[model samples]
Target: MAIFTIDDVEKTFKSGDVSEKILKGVDLALNEGEITALVGPSGSGKSTILTIAAGLQKATGGQVLFEGKDMTQMSQEEIRKIRSSEFGFVFQSSHLVPFLTVEDQLLLMLDVAETKLNKKQQKQEVSKVLDLVGMSHRKDAYPSSLSGGEKQRVAIARAIIHQPKMLFADEPTASLDSKRSKEVMEIIRNLTKTLKITTLMVTHDEEMLPYADRIVMMKDGLIE
Candidate 1:
């Protein structure tokens, strides 16, 4: 089955007596282990689509199915559980905790409820993911000490650390130089492939399209 299916989804908002339609019956799917890029100009609702898929926002109409279950029907607590166990996220900003080391940032994503790992095993898992993102050398470093590229890598590591089935990334390369952006994209693509994690990224940079297996173009909230 497809990892995600957004079937005729729509979102609307109100602005003090003014009603605005953002996403207008958009349909899309994310398959396992592939990189899908959502590209568009400003105000096309690309971020809105990501937010809805991530369950951060509810669609006004239609269904969002993750792993064949309807997202619209789940309770708030159930949704939170699904978000924690079934999905991961990476944003343009690293959004790392100011007080946590890079390693701790990743550990925070692991399965804490059913975890059988001791401190040593947990450290090993952290080491494995840090190595995957090529951030092992800086595992002990705080977010303030890392470069933009390194910080993004750590964010990616944290997202995938728990082996979530899907990942949503919004403008992940927005802050980096061209070279660093390409490197970060390559790392994301490679790791997604290796882990068989379905990844959807929102971006406006045409240079990064080549890294995506599929590109979904949005215009005025409709997929073009």
Candidate 2:
């Protein structure tokens, strides 16, 4: 079933006298436990739609429904709560805290998500997620000491540590080479499927498209 829906969504940017419409009546659905990839040329609004659905940005018009809740109608606090607790995100950059170890990073996410697990339970959860991303051994390593791929793996582990209901990934493998990119994609697919987390990703890599369960193409701000 569709846990998330975008209905006639529109986004526009205005600069003084100039106005540009980025998304024109976009309608899409993200189903339960599936990965959906949004693909389009630059400026086609794929990333805009992803952020809108993720609650990182607002739609100029129409509804962004999460589990049937109209997010566009929600207050900022309400939207922020959902984004922090129920959603996960992975970006092109690992974006890890330079000072934190792999395990500490996951712990920080739990703190941010307001997870109710005790310290021991949180540590166990961190270990499990690290193992999921094949980063268990590097749990004590800081970001600076890790390779690019390892850092990204740690980022993935941190993203899912709180067991978020939805995952939003934007060009998650763009910083890696072909081998590392494939590895990262496989980890993302396997983790989301195994944990039954719904995912929406915006990616330009054709090689990564095969990992997504559905591919939605966009042109001129509309799904094609």
Candidate 3:
């Protein structure tokens, strides 16, 4: 079943008297436990659509549905709550805390999401996710000491630590080398399958297409 859907979504930006339309009537549906990749050249609105569906930005027109509820209609507080709990994000950079240990990053996410797990349970959950991302050995290491791939692995661990129902990855592999990129994608794909988390990702790397279960091509603010 589709856990998330974006219907006829449109986004327009205005500065002074100038206006630009980033997304124009785009539609998409992401099924449970599947990875949907949005691919296109720069300025194609791929990232805009991802951000809109993730509730990070407002859509000028149309609906963004999460489990049949229209996200566009939700209040800012409601959206923030959902963004903190049900959804997870991985950006182009690992975006980890340079001073925080790997384990602390996941701990912070659990705290932010207000997960039901107690301190001990939260630590255990962190361990499990770290193992999944192959970063268990580096749990106590700070981000600054880790390699790029290790940092990304910890970032993935942090993203999934809350066991969110959906994950949004924006150019997740953009900062990695080819080998590291493939490895990172493997972890993401395996986690989505094993945890049944629906994922929508924006990636410019054509080589990464194989990791996605569905591919949506966009151009000039519309799906093509």
* Two-way lDDT contest, 1 vs 3, winner: 3
Residues 32-95, candidate 3: write the lDDT tens digits.
Answer: 9999999999999999999998899999999999999999999999999999999999999999
Q: Residue 110 deviation, candidate 2, in Å?
A: 0.8
Q: List candidate 1 stretches off by more than 4 Å.
A: 111-116
Candidate 3 to truth, TM: 0.98
Residue lDDT tens for model 2, 18-47: 999999999999999999999999999999
Q: Where in model 3 is the C-alpha error above 4 Å?
A: none
Question: Once superposed on the true structure, which residue ranges of model 2 sit more than 4 Å away at CA?
Answer: none
Kindly report which residue pairs in candidate 2 clash with one another: none
RMSD (Å) per prediction:
1.3, 0.7, 0.7
Task: Report the C-alpha lDDT of model 1 over 1-224, residue by residue, as the tens digit.
Answer: 47899999999998999989999999998888988999999999999999999999899999999989999898988888888887889999999988999988878777542346777888898999899889999989999999999999999998888788999999999999999999999899988999999998999999999999999999998999
Q: Residue 39: error of model 1 in Å?
A: 0.7
Q: lDDT for each of the candidates?
A: 0.91, 0.94, 0.94
